[model samples]
Target: MRAGDTAPILAVPLLLLAALPAMGFADWLTLSASGLAMGMLLFLMASGLTLIFGLMDVLNFTHGAFVGFGAFIAASVWARLPGLVAAPGLAANLLALAAAGGAAALVCGGLGLAFERVVIRRVYGAHLRQILITVGAMIVAEQMSVVIWGPDALTLAKPASLASSFIVAGGAVEKFRLVAAALGLAAFAALRLVLARTRIGLVVRAGVEDREMVEALGYRVRRLFVFVFAVGTALAGLGGAMWAVYAGTVTAGLGGELTVLLFTVVVIGGLGSVSGSFLGALLVGLITNYVGFLAPKLALLANVALMAGVLLWRPRGLLPLVRT
Candidate 1:
């Protein structure tokens, strides 16, 4: 990819940030920003899922559990160490919050790797069996989360300074959500760069296209699979942390239909396609935001309708290319 192509991706959030000041607070800017923010988080989570199932061909039914686990971790940190998160200075607070994110991602990565080795590895290529195993694992993980965190819903706390909401046109946009949106965009850019410019990315791309050949060439395909799995799970974990930070809450809804909608976004974007994921995300983001206002009763229905239209019209997804 050329630098010119990369420049536009880097420019989107900049453009959005610039537009923020011009819009009336009540004007749809807050909803647009929030929708994009949530959409970006979905992009992060779905990127990992698509890569695992689309490329490495691993069925990770427990991916949501990883996100839930990460959210719980961030929630715990904020609940325990409010001082560090609320500390003054952008650099310091960002660093501290990033540390918390790193911890959550790494923990989730370890769990994902272990699960792949002990459980998912056994069912490679067996979609039916993989589904069963993953579903079972999901059950176990859900039960564990509830047991540890209790049945009550827990809300994450933003630093006192960030919890403040600004009036935008008649709407309210939280300061912390703006930060989350910016960070989420950064994560999207970083993931794109990794896939486009790195050697591991090349191997991952190749593995997705032809794992048998990659392994026959004396490459450690299993290790590559494990790496991809870990990365995907970590992204989901990061999304969880970001969500906890943005929404200030954690609940078992992580494994139910809410989780299914996320997966649907992944599918609509096309499995294992990074650029496709972002594009699909923007579409879903816009649809969800606008439909909620026009037909509040069918907000979820709107997203589903959009996905169905894409699937029925293009079964393989809008973008179906595997760069090897």
Candidate 2:
């Protein structure tokens, strides 16, 4: 989609206004920021899946397991580095968080490589088999996590510096939420720059459109695919670490619970479009937060309703990529 497209962008303001009837300006601001933060975190978790699906046409049900794994890894790291996280200075706290996030990403990226080699390689190009095998893989991964971490939820406290909120005009805006939104924006920008300006990104995009042709051009498409998968998995892991801090707890089933929502964002955004994913995530986040506050009973159904409404309007999603 071109920059001129405004339909998706317009949805944000409309949704914000729709919530005005239920609360005052301060409440609205708080909810809006919260919703945007939630959306960004979702985008982080879902973006990689969208890329993998768009380029490799892989139905990776086990993607959620990576999220859970990343959260647990980061939590373990934090547990071991309590002093750094609870330090008085922001730099120390941030450093601890970065360390945990880096560790999670590295672990998940390596795991993704192994997953592609062992489980995913056998069923390439077969959607049904891909789904089945990946789902099975997810179940196995979840069970293994339980055995390793115990079947209980783990607490993940934000660094002391990030645990507080600041007043933004009269509304309290969380420090971590703002940080998450910034990180999400940074990730989006970096991804776009890589795709638009880098040689590897060019090869990846070309491969997405026509793998055979890219291979015919003498590029190592297979290695590129593996690299893309690893990157995607790492993104998911990083998102999970952020989410763990956001939620204050991490469980083995964290990824499973979010699978439906992640897929909804991906589908609404279009299979492979990063911008679409960001827009869709924002919509879902706003709808969820607003409805949850205004009409708690309908909160759970908000995303489903939003998805149906969007698909009914645009069957291919808001900004579906035109496959070459």
Give Cα distance to truth, residue 156, candidate 2, Å: 1.8
lDDT of 1 by residue, 1-324 (tens): 323344324433554454455545574677676778778877877788888886767667788888888888777766776677777655656765787688789888998889888998899889889889888888888889889988888886576667778886678787777777777688789877887789887777777778888888888988877888898888888888888777777886664534676677777777777776776676676567666765789988888887898788667665655545
Candidate 2: deviation at residue 235, Å? 0.6
- Model 2: per-residue Cα lDDT at residue 238: 93
* lDDT (Cα, tens digit) per residue for candidate 2, span 132-185: 998998889899989998999999777889888989878889998998899888
- Compared with the true structure, all predictions reach lDDT values of 0.75, 0.88
True lDDT of residue 43, candidate 2: 91
TM-score of each: 0.86, 0.96
User: Lowest lDDT 10-mer window, candidate 1?
Assistant: 2-11
lDDT measured at residue 312 in model 1 versus the true structure, 0 to 100: 87
Evaluated at residue 233, the lDDT of candidate 1 is 88
For model 2, the superposed segments whose C-alpha errors exceed 4 Å read none
